[model samples]
Target: MRTSYKNITGLGSAHKGVGHFIKQRVSAIALLILVPLFLFQFLASFTTGYSGVMAWLGSPFGAAVTFLIVSAMVVHMRLGLQIAIEDYFGGAIRTVALLLNSFIALMLWLIALYALIKISFGG
Candidate 1:
């Protein structure tokens, strides 16, 4: 009886509980570690100018770090925005907002990855 009601309404359940929360927290942790590494490299790149910056990005280690930073950053952004949209919006608006949030995050990640790969390969 109780189980049937829960299945019908999709409420009073612990199914998939805190999965999104855990993911967001994990991504935040990754960014906390990666941001300082990025800042240090970025700041030092300023001294050497454009070519130097490109060179750093072109290297394997630099490219990998930058990739990780961008990946984590985008995931965190998407998760955060998703929570906001889900909390504030409803019905069609919530659906649309969620879709847009995902699309924007995907685009940002793709653009950054493309540029990073291009620079790494001297293109």
Candidate 2:
């Protein structure tokens, strides 16, 4: 048996790539479903005023859905950005970009979750 140069170079599989790929796809599907629900809720709440919106958020179902959408969106964004950074950048730049991407995602998620909790608790 003869091994090709590409195979011998060990550049074929990253092993963890599949996990990232699957997570990206799953998050995409989740966003696809959740986004429409969010938009509809947003549009429907337009005439409800601030109190109405707050009350809606206070519901268990509303809070859960809001959390799900934000969580999935952040995860999807982080994974996509990481892939782009890995593919285009190198060395310290890639590491820095990945770190920044993760930090931004985490911040966004935390902010969103905080808002949801505050609204749910009437704060």
Candidate 3:
């Protein structure tokens, strides 16, 4: 094969298969952890009501973890949707779909970050 400036990951080569698989599996594991953690948090909120929910969200560690959750979720969503778009859509529609997904993802991440900051700062 001819050598080029492009990285293996960029060219989608199998050379770095081990690291890629590890990262993919770790992210999947994180999703499993984050999902139930978030749901449990919300259920606890249901027990305590709005202010309790806010307080939990507003706590220092809570905010930090929330940020991490958002970051991981966005990464996971991007990966999932990328494959979906590539597999399902074609031509201009594929491009549009990918662009739309990217925009939506960024918006969601920003919203989560904003909420985290607001609660963390007691706003």
Candidate 4:
């Protein structure tokens, strides 16, 4: 019988493997679908001019889709950054980097959501 170091030490991924991988992939797939839709909608809206664009954003469907796109993008970005930070950093620096990454992602996501809400409400 062969025993690995991980089994001997009981030190492994600390439960941050499969779930992280799944979440990252799911977010990526969501972005793949949402980005093109967003681009087409944005480009089409551009042809109609500013007011038309605003009108579309102000609509329920537009706001909802935009929100979804932003949410997925933020999630994907945060997870990707987290992986990079974890791989390259350690100890205090890793903690700081992770905290900063999450904070920045949350801030940006909130800002985007707020803008979407404002546009949806015509405010």
Q: List the residue pairs that clash in candidate 1.
A: none
Worst 10 residues of 2 by lDDT: 9-18
Model 2 stretches astray by more than 4 angstroms? 1-17
Give the per-residue lDDT digits (tens) of candidate 1, residues 46-93.
Answer: 699988999889989889889999999999999999989989999999
Candidate 2 lDDT over residue span 1-123, tens digit each: 899655776445663435787899999999999999988886776579987777767789878888999999999999999988999999999999999999999999999999998888767
Return the top candidate by TM-score: 1
- Which window of ten consecutive residues has the lowest lDDT sum in model 1? 3-12
User: So what's the TM-score on candidate 2?
Assistant: 0.82
The local lDDT score (0 to 100) that residue 7 gets in candidate 4 is: 68
lDDT over C-alpha atoms for residue 114 of model 2:
91
Best by lDDT: 1
Regions of candidate 3 where Cα sits further than 4 Å from its true position: 1-24
- Candidate achieving higher TM-score, 2 or 4: 4
Each model's Cα RMSD: 3.5, 4.1, 3.6, 3.9
Between candidates 1 and 2, the one scoring higher on lDDT is 1
TM-score of 1: 0.85
- Candidate 4 accuracy as TM-score: 0.83
TM-score of each: 0.85, 0.82, 0.77, 0.83
lDDT of each: 0.90, 0.87, 0.78, 0.88
Model 1 CA RMSD to the hidden true structure, in angstroms: 3.5
